[model samples]
Target: MRIGILTSGGDCPGLNAVIRGAVLNGIKSHDFSFVGFRDGWRGVKEGDIFELPRHQVRGIAKQGGTILGTSRTNPFDGENGGPERIQATLDRLGVDAVIAIGGEGTLAGAKRLTDAGLKIVGVPKTIDNDLDATDYTFGFDTANQIAVEAIDRLRTTGESHHRCMVAEVMGRDVGWIALHAGMASGAHAILIPEVPTSMEQIFGWVREAHDRGRAPLVVVSEGFVPEGADAAFSSRGVDSFGRPRLGGIGEVLAPLIEENTGIETRATVLGHIQRGGVPTAFDRVLATRLGMAAVESVAARQWGTMVSLHGTQIHRVPLRAALDNLKRVPAERYAEARILFG
Candidate 1:
């Protein structure tokens, strides 16, 4: 059977690994031929694609980004777009199935196409680990690991200058990246999008940390909203998919923190750095397994389903399961981390 694969949304650490895994598994086990769509849904809509043979995927497991490339292409745009157009394109190309590797928006679009009678399987690819169905996603570990290393490096500089360093990481609607990285880096405080943190509380934490003869370190998600503030200012703009850009929270918070606490504060936004790099060993393994499971789903014709990691095993679930709700940091988990706060 011939299959088509597309990677969508933002670039991720383990995206190349997933492509490699799928190509290797599908060819070796199922004797399947593969074609890759360029630049996400736009490629499918425009019929822009090329063959993705097994050799084309070699030595890419540790590579960052994707060989097929990606984009925030809206599948609902243009006169010749949406589910009907996509279905016709797949059928015309003689492709038997599709494997969509992306985050929530990409998966939702693919699900719509699937519901319209197209054969497709999904692989959850949120770097924030926000998808609720799976225990984890591939890029989150690599991103968190990168953030932790940056925090560790910044801690020394902050100590030398006696400054309260605020490190910002990505987490659009959740705090998984900040939470894990903060805990690992021994951050004095962690601010996330899910919790509305007040400037006064931030000041208290910095003051307490300073009194203990240590340079305070703060880790916050880019989407963090300060209490009684207008969501830490407006976003830059929306993407092609109409999702708002989430950032500048750290930059806005740092000044307020310094003014209120009388401490030198500096904000460092770790933008894009966390998302680009060789993936961690954990991420490589998980992404590979998820990719292989996606192939299995296609063989079973499990339309509108996605491969998910439940504990140590990979399983397939309905697309709705993955999109039911975002997996935000729970109160209890936050409380446990909060106890270590000032």
Candidate 2:
């Protein structure tokens, strides 16, 4: 069988590992030929691709980013897009099935195309860990580790200067990254979108930490909004998916904390750093397993399905079931972490 693969949405640490896993397993076990779409859905719409033999994907398990590259292009847009055009392109190229590795937007597109009779499988990919279908996604662990390391570094500088340091980590609609990183790094306070905190409450935490002869370390998710605010702070813009480009909450919170608590403060945005670099051992293994399972799904002719991690095992689930609702941080989980708050 001639199978096509594409990596979509924001680049993450375990992307290359997924490509390696799928290609190796497809070639070795199933004797299947593989090709990679160059830049997400755009490549598929334009029929731009390259051959993927065993040699092309060798030694890329620990590598960060993707060998096939990625983009935020919606497969339903443009004149050459939609399921009809995509299917025509696939027919011309003799591609039998597609394995899409990406976050929500990418999988949604795949689901739509599959409903139109396309053979496609999905592998969930998001550092936010917001997809409810899978117990855990691949890039979350690596991103959490990166955020924790950044907070640890910020702590030493904050102590030296006797200032409150606010670290912003990426979490658009969920606070998994910020919550795990803050708890792991021993942050004095952790702010997340699931819990809307008042500035007064944040100031109180900072003041309390300072009074205890400690440098206050605040970790916040990018999507976190103050209690009175109607939305998360976002002035940058929106992406192709029409979701607001969320960030700069740390920048907004830094001055407020300093002014309210009379303590010097600084903000550090750990932007794309969390998305790059070698993946953690946990992420590498998980991504690899998910990728191999995706190939198995393709062999089984499971269209409109996604490979998900259910506890220790990888299972295939319907695309509709996976995209039904975003997995959010439960209030109980946030409350448990709140116990460590200053």
Candidate 3:
């Protein structure tokens, strides 16, 4: 069998591990040939690809990002794009199945192609841990670790200067990263998109922490909007996929926090840094397992299914099930996080 793989959306650690795992497992166990799509779905539409033999995947398990490259390009765009053209392109390449590794958008497109009669499998890839179909996604651990380290470093500086520090991590529509990182860092205040916090509440937390002789540490998701702040306040602009470039929420909150609490404040946006560098051991193993499971699903003809981590096992579920509800930080989890807050 000839299988093609593509990684789309934001780049994250452990992506290369997935590619390596799939190629090695498929070639060694199933006698499968592999090819990789360049720069996400645009490669599929434009017929841009390269051979992905088992030998080529050597020594890449610890590598960050993907060997196949990635982009936010929608597969349904352009003159030569869409299910029909993509089907023709795959047929021309003699590809039998496609494994799409990405976050929400990429998997949604893969689902569409499957409905259009193209054989496709999905692997969830989000640092946010937003997809509910799995216990956790591959990149979340690496990102959470990076965010916690940043907050820890910032905490010390805030202590020395007697200031309130606001550290923003990625979470465009949810607060999983900020929630975990903040709880892990013992942040005084944790703000996320799911919970709209008022400046009044933020000031209360900062003041209490200050009174307790602790540097006020605040963690906020990039998508978090303070109560009464306009939704457009966080928009930096949109990307090629029309997804807004989320930022400035931490910066905006810093001054408000300072003015309300009479304490000096600073903002640190932990932007792309959280998504880069070496993946944690957990991520590498999980991504590899998911990659292998994806190929297994393909061998079973489980089209439209995504390989997911449920408890200790790698399982398969419909792509729609994962997309139906994004796994946001629930109220209970946020409440537990608040137990650490002032």
Candidate 4:
């Protein structure tokens, strides 16, 4: 069987591990020939691909990012869009199945292709850990660990300068990254997009920390916004794909907290830093498991299904379950962090 693979959406730490695991396992066990798409769905539509073999995947487990590359190209737009072109390309290449590794947008496009009669298997990939149905995605642990280290480093500077530090991490609608990292780093306050915060409440936390003679460390997700506030703080504008350009939330929150509480404040946007670098051992293992399971899905001819991490093992779930709703930070989890907030 000729199988095609592509990585899409934002880059993450464990992407290459997934690709490597799939290629090695699939070739050894299933004897499936593989082709790697150059960039997400665009590669599928344009038939931009390279032959993948076991030798090509050697020594990539610890690497970050996808060797096949990625992009946010939404194939659902305009006439002669991705679905039609993808079908044509598959026919031309004689590929029997596709393995899509990406976040929500990528899965949605793959689902559409499946509905249009293509055999597709998905592997969830996101630093945010927001995809439903999966207990945890590949890069979330690594990204959170990276964010925790950044906050730990900032703590020393914040204490020395007697300033309130606001560190922004990644998350669009979910706060999994902020919540986990904040808890790990002992942040004084953690903010997320799931819970809209007011300027008054924020200042209160900073003031309380200041009164205690300790610099306040606030961790926020890039998608976090103040209630009744403009969205530009989190996004520059819409892209060609119509999704907001998410970044700069810490900058916006920093000044507001300073003005409200009269405490010296700073903001550190850990933008792409969280997505780059070597993945944690945890991430490498999980990504490898997901990739191997994804190959099994192909061998089993399971279309419109994705490999998911459920507790101790990798499980196969319907694509609709993974993409139906974002798995957000639950109230209980947020409340646990709230217990330590100043």
Candidate 5:
């Protein structure tokens, strides 16, 4: 059988491991031929692809990012015939199934393609770890570890200069990264997009920390917005996939916090750094498991389903189920994180 694979949305650690795992297993065990889509959905739409073989995937397990490349191109954003075009491209390539690895937008696009009679299997890939079906995505643990280490380094610098340090990590409309890393590093304050905190309340937290003679370390997700502060930072621009760009909240919030409180402040946007570099051992194992499960799902003809990590086993979940609601940091989880707050 012939299969296709593509990675989409933001680049994350362990992507290459997933590609390698799927190709290696499919080729060795099932004698399946695989082709990779270049630059995400655009590659599928434009017919840009390359063959995947065992030798091509050698020694890529520890590597970060993806060999298949990725993009934010949403085929359905403008054209009505996008699905038809995709079908034509599949026919030309003679692929029997497609394995799509990405976050929400990519899965949504996959769902549309499946409805249009394409055989698609999904594997969740979000640095935020916000997909509900899986307990965790491959990249989330790596990102959280990176952020925690950064916070640990920033703590010493913040204490030496007696300043408030705000470290920004990626999370759009969810706070899984922020909550986990903050709890892990014992951050003074953890801010997320789910619960908007007032500047006055935030100032009080900072001041209280200052009074206790502790240098404050605040971990804020890039998607976090201050309460009633939409006038300052509006989501108005389109990304490559036509999704609204969600960033810059940390830079905006830092200045506001510094001005409100008398504490000297600095903002460090972790940005793409957390998504790059070698995958941790944990990520490597999880990604390999997910990849093997995805291949099995294809073999079983489980279209419109995603391979998810539930407890110790990789389970199959409906694609729509994972995309229906974002797995935001719940109130209880936030409360646990708050216990570590200064």
Candidate 6:
């Protein structure tokens, strides 16, 4: 059988690893030929593709980003889009099935195509770890490690300058990255989207840390909003998915903390750095396993399903399960982390 693969949405650390895993497993175990779609759904809609052989995937497991490239293009929007056109393109290319590796938006599109009788499988890929059906996703571990390291460095500089440091990490709708990184890096305070915090509370933490002869280190998710705010801070517009582009919350918090507590403060937005570079060992293994399972799902003709990590094992579930609800940080978990706050 011949299969097509594409990686979509924002690029993540373990994307190349997933491609390598699928191509190698499908070729070796299933004797399947592979083709790659370039730049996510746009490639599928426009019929842009290239051949994938064993050698093309060799030595890419540790690499960051994706070999097939990616984009935010919605598959249902455009002149030559939707299931009918996509199916025709697949038939013309002689592809039997598709394995889409990406976050929520990409998988939703795959589900729609599958509902229209297309043969497609999904592999969950997100650094936010927000998909509800899986215990964890591949890129989250790598992104967490990157955020922790950056926060650790920021702590030292903050101590040297006797200033309060605020580090912003990426978390659009969930706070997994900020929660884990802040805890690991010994941050005095952690602000997340799940819990709205008042400026008085944040200023109290900063002042308390300073009174103890310590430089206050604050870690915040990009989606965090102050208690009285109408919404998360977002200067940039929405993406193709119609979701608001979230950021600059840490910048908004920095000045407030300095002004309220009379402490010098600086803000550092980690930005895309968390999405780049080699993936961690944990992410590499998880991504590889998910990719391999995706090929197996294709072999089984499991349309509209996605490979997910439940506990220590890989399993397949309906794509709708993953899209049902976003896995959010529980209040108990946030409370446990809050116990260590200044």
Q: How high is the CA lDDT of each candidate model?
A: 0.90, 0.94, 0.91, 0.89, 0.87, 0.94
lDDT of 4 at 288: 90
Q: lDDT tens digits, residues 122-178, model 5?
A: 999999898889999999989999999988999999999999999988887899888
Q: Which regions in candidate 6 have their CA more than 4 angstroms from the true location?
A: none
1 or 2, greater by lDDT: 2
lDDT of model 5, residue 11: 90
Model 2, range 1-342, lDDT digits (tens) per residue? 999999999999898889989999999999999999999999999999999999999899999999898999999999989999999999999999999999999999999999999999999999999998899999999999999888999999999999999999999889999999999999889999888999889999999999999999999999998999999999988877778999999999999999999899999999999999999999999999998999999999999999999999999999988799999999999899988888
lDDT of 4 by residue, 178-239 (tens): 99999999888899988888878888888888899999999998888787876636347776
Q: By the lDDT metric, which is better: model 1 or model 5?
A: 1
Each prediction's RMSD to truth: 1.0, 0.7, 1.0, 1.4, 1.8, 0.7
Q: Can you give the lDDT of residue 290 in candidate 3? A: 90
**For candidate 1, lDDT tens digit of each residue in 1-342?**
999999999889999888888988999999999999999988989888999998899999899999898998888789769888888888888888999999999999888888888888999997899997999999999999999999999999999999999999999889999999999998999999899987788889899999999999999998888888665454688767566777888888889889988899999999899989899999999999888889988888899999999999998899988888999999999999998886
Model 2 residue pairs with clashes? none
193: Cα error in model 6, Å? 0.7
Stretches of model 1 off by over 4 angstroms after superposition? 230-232
Which residue pairs collide, candidate 4?
none
Q: Write the per-residue lDDT of candidate 6 for residues 115-213, one digit (tens) a residue.
A: 999999999999999998999999999999999988889999999999999999999989999999999998889999999999899999999999999
Q: Which is superior by TM-score, 2 or 4? A: 2
Candidate 4 clash total? 0
